[model samples]
Target: MKDGDETRQREDTPFYDHPTGGWGSLKSVARWMVKGRPSPGVLDTLRIQNKPGGHMCTSCAWAKPPNPHLAEFCENGAKATIWDLTRDRCTPDFFARHSVTELQGWSDHDLERVGRLTHPMRYDAASDHYLPCNWDEAFAGIGARLRQLDPRSVVFYASGRASLETSYLYQLFARALGHNNLPDSSNMCHETTSVALKSTIGSPVGTCVLSDFEHCEMILFFGQNTGSNSPRFLHPLQQAVRRGCKIVTFNPVRERGLIEFTSPQEPGPMLTGGSTRISDTYLQVRPGGDIAAIAGLCKHLFALDDAGGGVIDRDFIAEHTDGFASFEANIRETGWDGIEAASGLIRADLEAVAEIYARSPRSIGIYGMGLTQHVHGSQSVQMLVNLLLMRGNIGRPGTGISPVRGHSNVQGQRTVGISEKPELVPLDRLAELFGFEPPRDEGRTTVDAVQGLLDGSVRGFVSLGGNFARAIPDQGRSDGAWAGLALNVQIATKLNRSHVLVGDGTWLLPCLVRAEEDRQASGSQTVTMEDSLSHIHGSVGRRAPASGHLLSETAIVAGLAKATLAPNPRLAWDDWVGDYALIRDLIEATYPEEFKDFNARMFTPGGFYRGNPARERQWKTTSGKAGFTTPTVLSALGAEPGDAVFTLMTLRSNDQFNTTIYGFRDRLRGLEGDRMVVLMNPGEMARAGLHEGQRVTLVSAVEDGKTRALPGMRVTGYDLPDGCVAAYYPEANPLVPLGWHDVESKTPAYKGAPVRIVA
Candidate 1:
């Protein structure tokens, strides 16, 4: 029941009351640096992060400002850099000291805390340990195993950590093996955003540039926690607030960063302990209620416009959009009673938000995972776009939809063709550039990949970089399915649960981290990353690799491809790995529209923005106009919770980023050395006959005949909606059923999980 370190008893913990991003952030950064004990040049490596001709921060994909501050990275960014640059190494000796079973007994945190992987390894089932293996033999064995299975039965999963060049090559490698089963980290996070935005505005990416915040009169946040997920974004929000911009937030939890923020870079705040108020209005909407809340805003806006308030942009809607009449009718037909019940907010609050929208000539709507991980996640996104469209928010300066992406290059990965859906990518261009007929069939998504494994249809899984076993939903089913795979391979930088959960033909190929230099046969190579706003920039690693045995991701992919497929006269895998510029040139050839002058544009100062047609009102939809759709469902979780049931939403701690747990201390949440605690509303706890600090188990309310329960969760009363509760992710991922996902996007419903507290 324990996870290495002792969980801080509830009696010893108090709620954090200080502002976000102040002295607390500095202390956390220093503590992490000390704990990680990064190499001597780690500080200098951080200095170039998000800077021109320097490596990008391996943290969130928040765009770097045109003129970045001297110390541009955030506390979490420092942790990620320090974590990647750690002196500790998981060597062959570490594997010799413990078997896979013994390592499985350790916490996720403990496994990674041992530090970066130092050598290539292949699992020896007889010895129950991973023995060091040369790259050649490992790739040969893997290629042989892969060749034995049907390409459709194999899954290639990638994390956002991979650079654009690496991702592009990864997809080509998969298709060369004869399938398009490419699923990346985006499938689990922002897949809904892509599906919805493409259907609505004809572009999958967000329309807002970072500078839009400065010019916007109002910024509305839904479901995103800026402080933890995208801390660097706080600078723009802080600046906007200083200029008297209106900031409104709607989330289940009252995040500290949305309430107030004190920038560490601000000398006045650091010296005087002053903090800038962030959200002028904070609404605690229920989990999975974003769609209803957005609908209410639209309804109120319609009412205002009907009364001749000059709220609706009639000219823009008539000129640039379609289905306005039906969209307006649906909004008007939806009763306030239903909206209030589903949203967990009164009509008055929505009206107030509508008033703010009406007053502001320019506005931006920002969202994150909170809105994306639900059964109606796609609909929720559409609703937000619908609300923006009512006021002609898109295709204008200081106004657009912004989905805060999690990983540094998650958006970039998708841009360079890491996708399951074949139609989303340019197949003709890929075939022309690579001299191979690419697969046209729809590939497997993360959810379908897990399903394929459970049903014995999938024989292999290859992850470019991610904690695949830990990050996926329904851990009980997924972990078992992973261990039963015919082949499992992880191209990674560090030790994690995924690497140890070995199966047949399992191999661990260590790769150079983001902060390390990636010198190939030609010369030192620099990879490019696309930020959330479509800005493409170069990232050239400066520090030495953690181990001499480490290979660049590009090299690893090339080695695997060369080993797997018979050499084609035109395909030069080794050549592409030797000089990345060649890879970029091919990328430009593949997507001339997006990556035109790819190599030249990537190194430009602050990078160039690949223009979005939606941003220019050049609608690429089938009807040649932005379309508005109506959502019939009021609640993402379906029916309302009966008696003891509560809507459970999983979230990340301040000490964590995605699935990587840096340490047990969550500074903003006031939890030290613990992550198994759940936050609940005081009234909700009292209603359920549970006291503060009560140790209880959470049982999934899904009627699947599966005993999905998480025991040993300490209850802590906090500020949240009355019928909603929050817990840390990956731990709570088991309670979320694999089938419970957005119907359109197939994104697992991690936010609106129905659960009941049991003693």
Candidate 2:
């Protein structure tokens, strides 16, 4: 029960200093399998085969390789699945023992660990506890609230966990109920990627597939922790390394995956008693400084072009790209002085990066939340595309821009009707297929939803899946905003902080997790999900329900639609839940271009890769070409020189997925049993008149006359840029203002919040 200093001391005893996913990964997997006993058989839970026949790993959105290794799933993926398949049950009886107020006092990790929800529970104000309710009664009441309230007053929030079928049904239900307020978790994480890429390459996804690593000569990582976030990704990276493909990483913190990694499944590396060095050159860029570094790369590229004839791809630029001359001029104007000052990197470092970029026949750029979670995040992504377009790195074998997604099927969710902006697709087509006029008005995003709640406009909130209260930014204000809602409904597999913090009338709907047997009236059903690379594949649940009270996400959405969109035989919401193929048929009709061979291609062992015109040199743009954009070079950290002030970026612990806490320990980071800690440089700590493991309050630099202080946070000295620090979030999310987000994407600038320590 010892906290912080004591618990961290326990984790500091290193078993091995080797790279990620070695024996360490195996040990972690084994520990989790047994940690929560009475769970599904370990092998069955891991889905040791391709989905539909089995199931997909319930973790990150890394592409499932065509010819997967003996084991495609990773230790973290196993942990994610095991966490879902827990032994203890959070039944109505368990809720009776602990009141809502009492449960609110528990930690997020403890809330998940207490057990799986066994029944649909309704919040009782008199007893101050959740009481069991039947499905019909709960659905009727929730439907009544939706019917009575103004359509705009309802906020329909979807998470990445829901299947494509469920997401489509949920979105349809919301639109049919005369509202477009579909705010999803993507608004928090990768919305910037979608916004930037769509404008640049006429696509919003990674152009490279899993096999691209084979032909790639060099891979550049900007702000991504590939080792911890996407462990399965290391297989290709390790392969590329063995093939003499150089790996260069730009991150403030030296992640284990980027350092040295031994692929545990690969016999040669794992048994050789040595680890593969992942990064040949690693540069520690300041937090939110990715744009500057990327701009530096572009500036250096132009510098090379000025010196010689061979550096610029003039033919490709003339034929396939737009705005090249202006882009080059902007890069030259920014110059190395501004780039070095903002990026925390010098001219020599950027020049070194450009040398590799110029020399390599094929190169790839990869990044995650670190790059996409900022005020200028969308522009930063376009800047990356600009760098890639310099050499025509996109639309060819082994070369492209990759925005590594954190959640499984997150991109897929957006692909299948989960959007606040209906302009993403043609409304006429949707109306023809569904027999209803789709709402055209712009809806609230995650931030907009919070504002709606605060302003008394949002009366009801429904979540498909996710810890909304914990996962979002501005938690203190958002939690307060939730209190004004008349109804709050959560359809989930497990318990989290969001369920505890609710409105006047609250309902917790216990739903089935991914790949859990979803037996419908038709017999057995399979749901499809699109991966990071947009490969749509079938994922069928094989495990029995955790409790008889559990219902599939698809069924829950269908039931809600049946109740809310009443007296509708033509739509047949009730029949669609009986068989998912009917749902797929409707989806294919709705999006014929994307889901063209919707049913046929899914039978393929891995799945079918959807059309990426950008990858094929087919630009679907206003000018019929890839557009080079002039991204405003906003300084990563806006703070002028004063004291030891630093730009703070929220980080995910090694043991977490979004807001779900697997454990209190971030073992890879050498920290344990505490979330309220900051990682800073030893030199910066000393200069600030602070010591290692010193606890201090952090105050937001961009406070609007209000004190944005996070007290009881411990500062630990480590290696980082002087004006930057890292802290694990949900804990640090409070410091990021709700309105402090990208203008284009509106994603909360979680990775680039300005803060300083107060002793």
Candidate 3:
């Protein structure tokens, strides 16, 4: 059938009408609770007791000995806790029973059902099996391979879980080995935000702390849902709401967190089902349209400034910023019709949002991936910075631009120089400190790393932690790229899809989890993490290692460095790894100004705060001031009328984090027992002639000629925008072409793709 005609036929089919709270959902939760040996209540108790410091609070990382006298668990935190504390364990015997070929067909949920890894294993290609390997051998093999490579070809990828000391040493080893290919997970996610913020305001990280959320009179949360993503920040949001702060949201999807959030921290009210209303004004903007929304607000503010309304902070602009005249001119030339069309919001709606923002004495703008994972993602963030600068809404209590980071120490990883492009001064300083000239050439990013693998440039792949294959877009190409590698090394706590998709040589080096104690050679080591708020705090693991075989990431890095650099040592690698203090000493020597007395500072209970230029309204741009960046006119990629195309957006399920599936249910969205279903607006469904619960095929209309026909996918009607459909990632990743990515950031445009529905 023709794609258009098939859509019509599918539309006519009856929807699978199921109750929101069915027995199936209950059974799923019950099964999740009691699937393993430990009872559900016992597991919950263990998680609570395991909370930072014997605190019942499950949300905050700062929960101390004396637990708060209230319900302290947020919904998302509960999910994370439950998933981490799962009783299931995949022992070595489990791998012995299942062959690689047999395991390949298993669903993501089914693969994870065997639970966490119990031992380190090396894949034997000849036997087509994974056998347990000694930590020393694993390190020796990895080190030997790394040493053999040109070092420039060996990419050391770090996830957010790596502590500051580990990240610092990782970067050091790469530099010492003559390569800077630190293609971290941050590159794929917040690299745009970092680039934009650094270019506009010097510092790449967020300017606001968690406590600052409480001081704001108004908060404009664009393209972010805090409750589901960063549940830890929900308490401050709840507090802000209780104190009568106006909260506004701009997103395509009406996320549950932005609608109503019950602070598991509040006692009687939480138990009685009392929840906090998050957004006072929710503006559903079209995908990739955030720049237009911010531009509209800027134009409105400029008009107000011209009318002598004092809406724009003239003093701050003149003193601390540049390019206002050009910015103003650009905004004047940007017609309201174009802004409205691009943003998919009327002038009145834009005006309403501007009115709230303009009226508030102190306001903050918080955003997430929705704003940064687009073609002009960096420019979108710049526009937000421009808006904030116009109103002088930064560097004050309760007012700043906050990008809610996904992982715990994502910001921290970047702070300690886990970057592909290391600055010359840092490298020079490293050389001065370590007695070796660091690599000068810029290295590969995540995209570059993938390309390296594809072109046979990358000889070895070493991941500190993360499921890279599944997390990256264009799964087929990514899998192929991974398969072409000469060696694959993963330091992880659990068995993931990436481990299975190995090259000729593969080694899964089991490592200590964040919840476990790391008794390093330097005694019990405490690692530091920079939270979303730029607060650098110490995270010391209190529990024993999950297994005795697991090694600390620091020790692992040290071991690899010692073994690899034995033949050609420009510097001493063994001495540094013997004590984490030496690593800190090098960090101090390299970044003296920022990390002065790193050892002493880490001993402090709360750690320390990093420098934020925005706090003082100081712009460290080339012109010594913040500069307004006017984005070029964005050309829409919407499908033509005859193309029979619909926009397909990929999303993370409520029970998943990136590619890791905790369960097959999205509780807040009311989706149960499935991740393959497509969520479309009822109007759009009718317009496309598609009915609910229709088993249809989704083919990409792009030139790549790739089609993913997800069969038996119930077409559930939802509140998405017109011409747009939403599906879970990895499952829907096949539809996204390998080359389809944001040009500036190389981030996969998972939210915007042209597709045609068929049956």
Q: Which stretches in model 2 have alpha-carbon errors above 4 Å?
A: 1-16, 47-52, 638-641
How well does candidate 3 match the true structure in TM-score terms? 0.90
Off by over 4 Å in 3: 1-73, 567-578, 603-607, 634-643, 704-713
**TM-scores for the candidates:** 0.97, 0.96, 0.90
lDDT (Cα, tens digit) per residue for candidate 3, span 1-759 = 123522443354322222222232334445656543432454434444323333222222321212232433444444544555456776788888987767777887677667667687888777777888787887788777776777777888987768888898888878888888997877767887888888888778788865676688999887775645665566567779999999889888777677666544345654575667778878878777788888898888878767888898888888888888888888889999999877878898888788888899799988887877766677778888988988888788878888877766777788788888776237777776667788888888887887777788988888998887777766766676666676788887677777788657688887766556677666776666666766555555656565677788887887778778744454555665566677777777777777877777664433466668767777766888877777775322333223467777788766776667877667656667767788887778787788878878787777755555556566888766666788888788777765666666676667776777886
- Candidate 1 stretches with Cα past 4 Å from truth are 1-14
User: Which lDDT tens digits does candidate 1 get at residues 92-130?
Assistant: 999999999999899998999898898999998899999
True-structure RMSD for candidate 1: 3.8
* Local accuracy by lDDT, each model: 0.88, 0.82, 0.71
Please give the ranking of all candidate structures by lDDT, highest first, separated by commas. 1, 2, 3
Candidate 1: 10-residue stretch with minimal lDDT: 1-10
lDDT for 145 in candidate 1 is 91
lDDT of 2: 0.82
